[model samples]
Target: MTVTAPEMANGIFGGVFNLNYSGDKNRLIWHRHWLVCISCGAYAGVGCFLFAPRGLMYGFVASLFTSCCSIWADYVHIEDPQHLAHLVDRWAAFHFFFVLVCECAYVLHMPIWYLTMTLCLALALFSLSRSSRSRQSWVLLHSAWHVLPMGLLLLPGLIS
Candidate 1:
């Protein structure tokens, strides 16, 4: 489905993943909302490692953690994401590094094609998130955050 589909037009994928900023900054600090993507990805990645270690399980799990940290930090902001955006950027860099580590370790070698697609997809998602303005879009971006992690979890078994 088109992420910006008019019918679902409020959250990330639709109104389903919509986010609302807390009016009081203090309201968000400890009472974090349990958003969907990262939480689900964390569980899925952990399960993948436990059931099937034929891939870069560690890398994937770490990737999920960084995502959760960035996201939780973004939403439940005791701090502002704008000034601290670099931390999220660093987290993103680490995520890719971990994914590459997994491919190198488990797959022997990663083809240029896979790596190129990874870069392209990352850039695309980043662009989408940055350009998106609506709460719905933020919701969608955060909700769709699992795409990369899930792909990481599955890549090993598919290739190997």
Candidate 2:
């Protein structure tokens, strides 16, 4: 039973797996979206250094958790729309809990809160970006929404 390239590529355990697991091929846009989320999380951690050391560390940890969850989802084949939607919601909820913890750390002047905020904002953007078609207008609108968190973060800074 020799499987042709396309057959293997589209199968559940072959190139389809390779493309997603290795991220060498863009067979599914979800793989690319996950990469974007990972990148954004990394950048957020790096950016947190400007605020505080703890923030950077926490951001890195949070990003690691997010990446791990994404990898698990891929491994479990949660790409069907129904499963994917649920996975997204679950991930968002988990992220929110972490955000709360980071907020507490930030309030105590621990610095990790700012990094959490950055990760949240970026994750939100990544979600919106991956939720719909890749139309320019939609992408722009989703990207704009992703940045809305800056206002929330900035408001507190101003008040303080």
Q: lDDT values of the candidates?
A: 0.48, 0.43
TM accuracy, model 2: 0.35
Per-residue accuracy of model 2 over 14-116 as CA lDDT, tens digit each: 2212222332232244332333333333324322432245455554555455544544443333334345533553464367445535554654453666657
Give me the runs in candidate 1 sitting further than 4 Å from their true place: 1-52, 55-61, 82-89, 92-108, 152-160
- Candidate 2 segments whose C-alpha is farther than 4 A from its true place: 1-34, 40-52, 55-62, 74-78, 82-89, 92-131, 135-160
Error of 1 at 63 (Å): 3.3
* Candidate achieving the largest TM-score: 1
Q: Which residue pairs in candidate 2 have backbone atoms (N, alpha carbon, C) closer than 3 angstroms, thus clashing? A: 55-112
Kindly report which residue pairs in candidate 1 clash with one another: 10-136, 11-136, 12-139, 12-140, 13-140
